[model samples]
Target: MHSKVLDRLLFKEDPVEKLQKETGKNVNDVHIDFNSGQTPQIPSQRYFQNSNIFINKHHRYSYMPAHTHDFIELNYMYSGHCRQYINDEPVALHAGNVILMDKDIVQKIDYVGESDILINILIKDDSILANVLNTLAQSTSLVTQFLVNASKVHAIHNNYILFDAQKNEVAQHLIDSLIIRGLGNDGSNAREVNLLLSLLLNELSHSIEAETHNFESGTDDLLQILQYIDQHFQTVSLAGIGRHFGYNSNYIGNKIKAETGFSFQSLVNRKRVSLAKQLLAETDYPIARIASEVGFSNASSLSKLFSKQIGYTPGVFRQRRHVLDVPRISRTLES
Candidate 1:
């Protein structure tokens, strides 16, 4: 299911040439950070050219050293098996198995055999996730827990979520779609990319079980709340959502705030923005129509919040190809 471009990049490119292009170093040159007695933890934003989403395939000789990223990383095992260490915990990644690792988590990839093929999908923390999670609406499962921890400062240490999709048709299809869309050189915009990613996450949430550490706690009630919000965000109120989940408004609000860092209204706004972005990118509908579709009363209201949250007016954001270029943080940690 891999694209021709992906095939060429993964198989045709010479290892030394690819390494120099990616790391800006010759094969024999040792990294200064590694030579300085510290594990090199590279930030995704820098290596990915500040793009919110980055995807690449790594071969055996291209196996990366022990490192960590400042963005969420999804390692999808397309073929063969890989041995990796996450916070020193050994993980065996078989074909069709995916591991979701959050930002700041230390990991190392051991030598991959000649037949192995693993794809790395790295997502910046604030850009696509804030909106995609709302559309996913799965707040309780192990997958949802990893996403939540990824967005927040507090993370479940030494833990990752695994999804085995070898036997699942829907999961496999979505995974393939993401890989193709992500690597294609065509004019596929960010909207389509995030949409595929959201759908992929939703599909996995339905069929796959999450593997989390003891610290990764999940609640069924939050799942109900998130699902309800996704379905009724256009018209759902705090009181109405609370009633649906058999909880009072105040109690529901507090629980949501505690679990997610977003309040009731803030969460709704995020969901609306997510929908609006999809519409803006995928359709030629008027701004007013897009606003109504995403639950906004009018275009002006939608524009106000959208600008506040995204920094660009809806029209500008769409015209710019749905790519929101937010400022990146420091890539390297101080030793």
Candidate 2:
């Protein structure tokens, strides 16, 4: 399925060799010093430049010794299979698997098969992630946990998350778009890449939330309720939620209050506001579009609620949280 995409993006020069030549060091030499057992040279500037995101094809063979990087790494298995060691624990990865490796997570790759086609997406900055994390702060899904842990700054942690996104079209499209746009010679628009990556993360969050909802436990009623709200806060009503859960509307409200110490409407509003904030911070969509996207009836209603809840108007929020650090490129993407 992804083979055609890989073929389209394929280059004659091997990427691993390209990186090795640019750095003037073999891949193995970049890792731990045998005497010190410490990684002395971190390839902070090789994978990614000043831009927060980097995409490249993985072309390495032989056993890769355990090493850590200063940037977060997303290993997308475009085809074939391989086994990896994350923090000394073996993990088998098949085609269509995407592993999220947090910064400082010690990892080593085993010998790759001849047919393997792996793509590497490295994130060199955390500011690109702040808005995405803040938007999905309410979620407790596996993806959310991975993002939260990856965003942390502690250097002593070893963490990796596997997302079985084989059947997800949204993820596949986003990954392909990222790879294509990144390979373009239009001078590497940082803002554009960040927005595309954020959209991908947002889609992954929804995918995990849906998976969580499908496999929910009977004892975790609050979790189920929150998951429902997370996915449908844009169009969900108290009565609608009650109907889906087989309870009366008033009873549902009372149950949410009892379990979470917050009213049903309050919880819904909070989730909606979080989405609005993310759209405002990460994209250049108009206020009306954002209001509609987050489930408000109109921009006025969104404005009233946003100002009342957040102590700031939506327009002001957008201006203050604007993420395009490059002002010149901001205008280009905003159009």
Candidate 3:
């Protein structure tokens, strides 16, 4: 059943490809409106009217010109291989590889043949992205830290993260699941699509072959510091991290605030709260224990900060999650 669905979706010719074949013209020439702007910026409105996640197959047999868009783009090489020039740098993508391009990045694709299947997954919703980043706050991966920092500030532009997941069966499965879900109902299953995308990103964060390109100066040191904080947030201090990185506390503290718009303590508190929420939802741990486990002094401290940041106390949040999960548990037992 999965094979049939994959074959139909991957092999079938879309309307644009049909037009290209009939007229012997590239997608750019066929769609003159795309070239109206000086740099040819693809607006979110063109493909994202009712959905924050949009999935489309890249048009084949045409040279896609250098252009920018107003949304994050994930290009998955589903089959075969193709080359693209991102920021005038050559990037070759093979089957099972995924590349995430941030907004306003100039990208030009070489002509792709019929056997080469490239899938475009465009995300335009900042709230969804924020939720993903929050869920990943405990991750010590430099890639995750880079993403968190890049999203919070505008210092990095024309940036991209490449994941050479050609050997990662898990990543490939997640990518296929995202494509299948997105292509199924035209945004009717948007919640599921977003969840799959989040899972995919989390998987990519741990990928050993992940690489980030076109980052601004000082980003590497900052990302390393952020990773250290994530790894030691329970007992991390400004002075401690400063010594570890061979810088003074004041300089490191100001840099964190400048790049992420949050003070050092604030970032640590956010990570603690993120872990507290996870434990509350998934464990039977007591509120005080959960608080201490996540680096809080006591339950009150957790509640004060949690309520301020998440608009709910730990007890209330756990109860709400329990209420939401009861029905699903009941349905499973009934079956």
lDDT by residue for model 2 (133-208), tens: 3344455655555554444343233556577778889888888777777653243465566667767776665543
Global Cα RMSD, each model: 9.0, 9.8, 6.6
Query: Per-residue lDDT of 172-257 in model 1, one digit per residue for the tens?
Result: 88777777767632334455667777777766766554565645356435556767877888998989977887789999998777
Clashing pairs in 1: none
TM-scores of all predicted structures: 0.74, 0.55, 0.65
Better of 1 and 3 by lDDT: 3
> Lowest-scoring 10 consecutive residues by lDDT in candidate 1?
326-335
**1 or 2, which is superior by lDDT?**
1
Top candidate when judged by lDDT against the true structure: 3
Worst 10 residues of 2 by lDDT: 208-217
lDDT of 3 by residue, 194-260 (tens): 6688778888866645455565534456666766877788899999998999999999999878766
The ten-residue window of minimal lDDT in model 3 covers 326-335
* Ranking of models by lDDT: 3, 1, 2
Candidate with the greatest TM-score versus the true structure: 1
